[model samples]
Target: MGDELIEKAQELKTMIQNSAEYQKYDSCRHILKEDEELYRKVNEFRKKNFEFQTEGSAENGQADRLAEAYADVLGQKAVMEYMNAELILCRKLQEIYGLLVGDLEFDLDFLQ
Candidate 1:
């Protein structure tokens, strides 16, 4: 049963890799990396965005700063395309995971 689950996971992984959203994201990622400076900026912005999200609340104009950084990077065509592609791919993964777990029952109100 464990081996069967692993095989099914690999098949799902392959299917995701072959998906249009993943293909576009992979292409845009390569294109984005062609510009090292832009890629660096994008990574930095991603770090800041992640921090902002995990913090759960904005403090001392952090939201504004993050927005400004986003606007700056997104003004570049490559960055905008890469970000959009990434978002689409992420949403696809989220949908897939949601479906896979939708039937599972869990109670964890303590975490909140």
Candidate 2:
């Protein structure tokens, strides 16, 4: 059963890889990987953006500042294209997960 599951998972992975969204994301990722400086900048921007999201404040509108900074980072062509493609792929994966989780209908109200 485990072997069969593994085979099915591999096939699913191959299908995803062949998808147009994944192909575009993979191509942009490869381009990003080739540019060390741009890649580092993009990562740094993403890190800070995530930080603001996970630990934001309403005192001085820190989220607003972070959003502006993120826009600036995204102004870079390579970063923008890669990020857009990456998000496309992520959303596609999320949709699949959502469908599976909805089908499972696990009762998690007690976990709260």
Candidate 3:
């Protein structure tokens, strides 16, 4: 049964890879990679964003600076398009994940 589930998951992965959203995201990623400077900037922003999100801390001006940097990065048309495509792909993946796991049974009343 576990093997069957793994096989089905692989099929779902292949289907996602064939999706338009994934194609666009992949294309934009390749384009970003072609530009060294832009790729560096994007990676830096993404790292900071991820760190901030995970830390859940907004020091005096940290949040503002991050927001400003975000605006600056997204102000570029290519970056904006890439981000949009990425967001679309992520949302699709999230929806699929929710549908797959939303019905699973779990006992977690301890935290409450």
Candidate 4:
């Protein structure tokens, strides 16, 4: 049964990779990777965004700064397209996971 489950998980992974949302994300990511300057800009933006998130309320105006930086990155066509495609892919994965969890009908309150 354990081996069967692993096989099924592999199949699910393949399905996700073949999904249109993932395909778009993969293509956009490849384009971003091919451009040295764009990749650096995106990576910098991501690092700053992550810092802002982790800081939470620890730093005033950090989020605003991050937002302004993000807006500037959005002004670049490649960055905007890649970011949008990545969002779509992430949402698609979230939907799939949520559907599976709903079907399982686990009682989470019991854990508490």
lDDT of all predictions: 0.89, 0.83, 0.87, 0.83
lDDT of 1 by residue, 15-77 (tens): 999999999999999999999998998999888887877896566678777878579787899
lDDT tens digits by residue: candidate 2, 1-112: 9999899889988999999999999999898889898788788877776776777553468767766866866787888899999899999999977875667866889989
Clashing pairs in 3: none
* Deviating ranges (above 4 Å) for candidate 1: 59-61, 107-112
Q: Could you give candidate 4's per-residue lDDT for residues 28-108 as a string of tens digits?
A: 889888989779888888787777678684278876766786786667777888999988998988998888776786668
Task: Please list the residue runs of candidate 3 whose C-alpha ends up more than 4 Å from where it truly belongs after superposition.
Answer: 58-61, 109-112
Question: In terms of TM-score, how similar is model 4 to the real structure?
Answer: 0.79
TM-scores, in order shown? 0.89, 0.80, 0.86, 0.79
lDDT of 3 by residue, 39-104 (tens): 889888878877877787666567678879678776887888898999999999999989999999
Query: Which sequence of candidate numbers ranks them by TM-score, best first?
Result: 1, 3, 2, 4
Whose TM-score is higher: candidate 1's or candidate 4's?
A: 1
Candidate 3 vs. true structure, TM-score: 0.86
Best by TM-score: 1
Question: What is the alpha-carbon lDDT of model 4 when measured against the actual structure?
Answer: 0.83
Model 1 gets an lDDT of 0.89
